[model samples]
Target chain A: MIAAIRVFGYSLFAIFIGLLFMGIGRKIIARIQLRLGPPFYQAFLDVGKLFARKSITHNFVMDLGMIMSLAGLLSTMLFVPVAGHMAIKTSSNLILIIYLMAIGHLGMAMAAAASGNPNATIGVSRALTMMLGYEIPFFTVMLGLIIFNGTSSLELIAQSQAGGILNWNMVKFPLGFLAAEIALQAIMGEKPFDAMVAPAEIASGPMVELGGKYLGLAFLTHAVSIFVETGIMVNLFMGGASNVFTFVLKQFEIYLITILIEAVFPRFRIEQAVKFLWTVPMSIAVVQLAIILL
Target chain B: MMDSPSYMLSKIAEKDNLTVYELFFGPNHPGMHGNFGYVLEMIGTEIVKVRPNAGHLHRGFEKLMEQKLWVQNIALVPRICVADPDPNEVAYCTAIEKILRVDIPDRAKFLRTITLEMSRLSSFLMGMGALAAAVGLYTAMNIMTADRDLILDLFEWLTGARVYHMFSIPGGVRNDLADGFVERLYKVLDHLEKRLIEYDKLLFENPIIHKRLKGLGYVSKEDAVKYGLTGPNLRASGNPYDVRVDDPYAAYPYLDVRVITQEGGDALTRAIQIRLEFEETINLIRRALKTMPEGEIRLNLGNLSALKVPKGEAYAKVESSKGEFGYYVVSDGGMKPYRVAVRGPSLPAGLLLAQKHLPKMKIDDVAAWMASLAICPPDIDK
Candidate 1:
């Protein structure tokens, strides 16, 4: 019962932090454009409003897919150690976390396909293609750290870099961190790599068919994924914090970098994005892997 | 009755391995400029065929102008192109002046030039913002819109109306420059010039934007002229056919109007052309202000409501932000015009060039492409 309570508390914490970061990100973007933005709690208000409205569902598959998407990301969030606190107290295997994260995307893809909208299908296809683009460099960076530390566990990786800021992987393996940063931008679906969600091109792509409660659920899923992805980045690059507050601070810093990049850059075409991902970050990751091997 | 038509077609499609779907790419889509649509047939995110769906914004503007008296048509002409309405008014008035063979006063000419250039600035801002937004950069859009509001504020101060300023009539503009207007104009110009550096950092210098826009829409020099492309789009394609320079009107003949052109006939070249022309327009306005002479503002036509023109026909054209806006007016010695035909700039590009360029292009490029061409749909429909 205590474990179940802890699990629920962790999910809520992740969702809250994620929503806060999104709101703050919008505020920062608006300031960059020389305008006053919404309050920092606006995402919460938006989610509340969406949930209060009615939703249209195309089929049972769509309903199941939306639920599965949220559930899968939530499950991934449970494995990430928050300031040394684990929800379920498992190994928190890095490979398992990566594998589980994909389930969230697959769930979204299934839902989009089931929606029977051409735009949604195109968005899902681009998303899956983008997955292929970013994963190679991301996994190569992970492989470098795994080989260096001789462990596949995220907790072990974080603990190894716990002595000081200088001991963090970000300082020791700057190339790998750079590659990971680029991959993270794509993972979060920010520009100049946001072709899948290209609002002008495909009428907001996958979200075209989503409305009301379904949109609310989509927002929650996006929030959870943001938390999970940033949490993973903090554990791998920065040393995971000694407390929950500092941990969230570290996650915010990572998210801030992505948001700053997202503010000024326009989207890349899917093929252009894939080509860039393969050449630039992929080369950087390869060089980092060589350094680790050498 | 062996097989239903749908089933037979499906079987044929399956045998051929074709999966083409129709997508309505406007009328309500975010990328669309106005109430215009394109029915696109797609096969795997690439456009297989395109059917331009016009007439969504058709208000019968040409037909509406025929019913109104000569002077009242000034209020209606500006609605033809909301982004750059001054050109429509100027073109209409110039056509009427040509038919009447009356030259507007020198002060009125300078004022008209200033308003026309200011309208060009605001329209260019909107065009660049729309282009940036099409590529998913809302920051650029927001900044440009904020800057455009400054121009609109100036317009309101001068003309008493913000958007459709019915300032220009048959003879001259309705009002003079307001109190301390030139100093305020200078301040706005200085502020915009400073903001250009920030825009460079945020949008123009960004490498991804160059990559996205460099060679997307390649119109050759010959094709540009063949397709009747004009203004910046034509100038970008290595043509120096500016109505302001070649066929001078307003204060253009008196002032030193320098024609700027580019060698590459691509989308990026066109964007660069607009940026360079925006700076040139600022200089043009400053020059016009400096050289403007104080004189009468209009030719007294005597009771404009009951005014009549001798039976004649004349055509007048002006360099709008989009391209050449021409008004062909025919008078029958009556209070109302016999015929008024507007030659809008966007019709050829929106209807003709799109047919040539849109097929085989990916879905993502459509919005950016439309924005690069600066295809305003209202003018096309009108």
Candidate 2:
């Protein structure tokens, strides 16, 4: 029972951290260009209002989508270590986390598809194409970890790199971490890679069809996703929660990187996105793998 | 729209469970720059068939001009196109000028160029925003609007209104450049030059945008002319025809402007052409301010209460930001015009040519192609 509470606590905490970063991130990006932006609590207010409205689902698939996303989110949380330890860090659970992430997207896509809007379908299609593009490099990065750590267990992987915060995957394989950083930015659906939700092209893509309570759930899933992937990056590459300030520091850095790129770059179309991931970022990941093999 | 060849797409699906359906991308989609759409037939991933639909915004500006008074039409002409309204006002005014044999003061010409160049910059900014949005770049779109707002602020200072400046009147302008406005404009120009570099980093140099826009909406030189494409669309296909040069009016004959063009008539070419034009517009404004002849801005409409002309018909054309806009007027020695047919360039470029070109692109690309054409809805509806 204590294990369940621990898992729930860490997972919720990570999500809260991500939620906090979204509003703060926008303000920082705005100031970089000599302008003032919204306050720190804006993210909370925005998310809160989304729930204030009654949940309205376009169809039964919408119901399934929210439920499945919540389920998959919890399962993935079981594998990710927070404060240097996971609630249930079994070896195979780390692999399960990857599947959960993939399946969570699948569920969201399914719901978006069932909304019966062309824009939604287009959004889902772009998201699928992006997933296909970014996942290859992500797997390669993971393969390097599995080979080096010699275990699928995320906790074991974290423990192997434990030191006075200097020994981490980022320091050991800087190239891999660099490649992963760019790839994760794409994976997170940040700006310059957010083709799926292109508002001008398809009216915010898939979310165009979803409204009311379904949108609220979808928004939460996205907010949590920012944390889930960022937490994984922190644990694998950066030292995992060495202290509260360190944890906050690393998370903010990740968020800052995303915002900076977003403010400075334009988006790619689906075809361009596919070509970029398949060529540039993928080649960089291969170079990272080559260094490890040598 | 005529039939799309549908030759490029290879069939991946069998006849049985998956049926091919035609989806009409109407005058309603966000991508459809103000009243434009395409008929798209898709069998899963590939677009096997397409057709461009237009004319949702046909207001008959030409036909309407014949019914109104010579001065009354001045108020109506600017409504023809929302993005660039100055040229229509000038085109109509110049045609009336020809009928009345009124030689506009040198000062009026300089002030006219100032407003015209500013309108061009504002229209191009709007086009940039629309194109960015169509290519799925929300950040680029927002950034464009943010920068475009500064230009609008300049317009407000000049004309006291934002969207519909109706500032260009017959014979001369409504007012002169206010105190220190020219110096302030130079500052705005300086700011614009610096912002363009950041815009390059955000939208232009970014490889993703290049991939999406570079070669998507391809139109050849011969085809561009045959289909009546004009303005940047015509120039993008390697044509150097601008009414500001080919016909020469206002202050363009004295002003030095090298026409901007690109060999490939695609979305990227259109976008790049706008960027080049933006730099040139700043140059044009600076020259107009420097060489502004000291004179009155407004010409009295009271000179023609009866609005009598020499009973001879005249036609005048001006290069709007969108394309070449022309006005052909026939006066019968009356207050109202006998007939004033306004030939809006966007009609041929957007309605007729949109039908011609949209068939060549995928359903998702419909908006980008439409925006590149730069069709203002009021112009089409008129």
Candidate 3:
């Protein structure tokens, strides 16, 4: 019962921080364009409004799929160590976290297919293809880190780099860091790599039929995923931070960098985006892996 | 579940020749610029057929013009083209002025030129923003829209209306330029000139934008002329045909209007051509300000309600932001025009040209192609 309460508390904390990151991202993009943006807590209001509205369901799968998507991402968050503590205390294996993350995306894909929209299907297919394109390079870079540290537990890898900024993996593995940055851009669906959700092209792609409560659940799932992904990046490269405040600040910095790129660039076609991922970043990851092995 | 889905699959597979899926591409959608829909027959992702559906913005403009008196039609014509309404008002007024045989003052002509260029600047900004939006660069769209609103501020100061300004009347403009309008306009133009460089860096030089738009919608020089494409679309195809230069109207006869052209005849060329012409439009506005002839701002056409035009017919054309917008007016010695017809520039681009080009394009390119062509649905439906 105590563990259940802890799990609930951690999920709420992750969601709150993730939604705050989203709101700040909007403000940053707005300031760049010389406009007064929404308040910093606007994302919370948006989710609240979404939950308050009525929703339509095409079939039983839509509701089940949405709940499954949220559940999948939430479960992934449980395994990730936030600052220095884990909601569910098992040795944090990097490979387990990666595999668990895919469940969330697959659940969303199943829900999108259940919606019976061609745009949704096309979006799901492109999203899956993009996942394939980014994962190869990401795993290669992660493999280099795992081999160098001689451990797969995220907490141990982060603990090894805890002395100072100079000891962070970002300073040591510069080439791997660069490759991982590009991979992260694709993973987060930022500009030049966001063809799956191209609003003008496919009418918002997978989220076409999602409305009301279903959309709220989707938004919550996205928030949790953001926390999980950025948390992993911080633990891997930014020394995991000594406390919660510093950890969240580093996550904010990473999210800001992504939004900065998104504000300036246009989207690529799906094929071009995949090709770019495979050629440039993949080769860089291979070189980084070679150095780690030697 | 397996039996149900298989039955449905077999039902779909029964039609061997019907492999295409039908999609309604927006009478109401984010990608659609306005109230326009396309019944697209798509095979996989490629568009196999395109049936352009319009009339959502139709207000019976031609018939409505026949009902209103000569002076009242000025208010009606501006509604025909929302993005660039000045062209319609100017064309209608010029047509009636031709029938009434009243020569507008030089100041009015120059003022008309200024307004026309300002209208073109606003419309081009909207077109550029839409092009960016189509390619998923919404930040660029927002920036362009904010800049376009600055120009609208100038319009509000001059005409007391933000969008539909019934400034142009039958004989000339309803009022003269407001106090210090030239100084404010110069400032706006300077700001826009500086912003264009940033816009180029963000969108024009973007590798992804180049990949998506470079050769997507190709219109050859011969095909352009064959299909009656005008404005920047025709200019992109290496045709140096501009109604402002070849068939000068209003103050265009006095001004040296340079017709800009490009050789590519593709979407990139069209976009670059508009950017280049936008600079020229800014220069033209400055030149008109420097050499504006001083005289009466309007011609008194007697009491508007009692005014009667002689029995005659005249067609007047203006080089609008979209293309050549012409107004044909038939006056049978009456207060109301006998017959009025609008040769809107968007008819050929939205209906004829879209039908010809949209057949083989990938469905994703449909919005981008329409944006580069700058087809305004209101003009088509009007």
Taken over the whole model, the C-alpha lDDT of each candidate is 0.92, 0.75, 0.89
Model 3 scores a TM of: 0.97
C-alpha-based local distance difference test score of model 3: 0.89
Report the C-alpha lDDT of model 2 over A74-146, residue by residue, as the tens digit: 6776677765655664663467678788877888788877666666777888898999899898878877888
**Per-residue alpha-carbon lDDT of model 1 for B1-382, expressed as tens digits?**
2354334544655765758777889988989999999998888899989999999999998888889999889899999999999999999999889989999999999999999999999999999999999999999999999999999999999999999998888889898997899999999999888888888777788788899999988999999999999899999999989999888889899999989999998888988898889999988999999999998888899989988988999999999999999999999989999999999999888999998899999998999999999999999998
Candidate 1 per-residue C-alpha lDDT over A83-167 given as tens digits, one digit per residue, 9 for 90 to 100: 7889997999999999999999899998888787778889999999999999999999999999999999999999999999999
DockQ of 2: 0.34
**CAPRI grade of model 3:** medium
Encode model 3's per-residue lDDT on B1-382: one tens digit a residue: 5444423533554564647766778887778977988988777778989999897888899998889888888888988898899999999889888998989998999999999999999999998999999998888889989999998998898889888888888778878887888899999999999998998898888888889999988999999999999999999999999999998888988889989999999998898888899999999999889999888998988887777999999999999988999999999999899999999888888999898899998877888999999988998888
Calculate DockQ per candidate and list them.
0.57, 0.34, 0.57
* Candidate number achieving the greatest DockQ relative to the actual structure: 1
Q: What's the C-alpha lDDT at position B20 in model 3?
A: 71
Query: Using Cα atoms with residue i matched to residue i, what is each candidate's TM-score against the true structure?
Result: 0.97, 0.90, 0.97
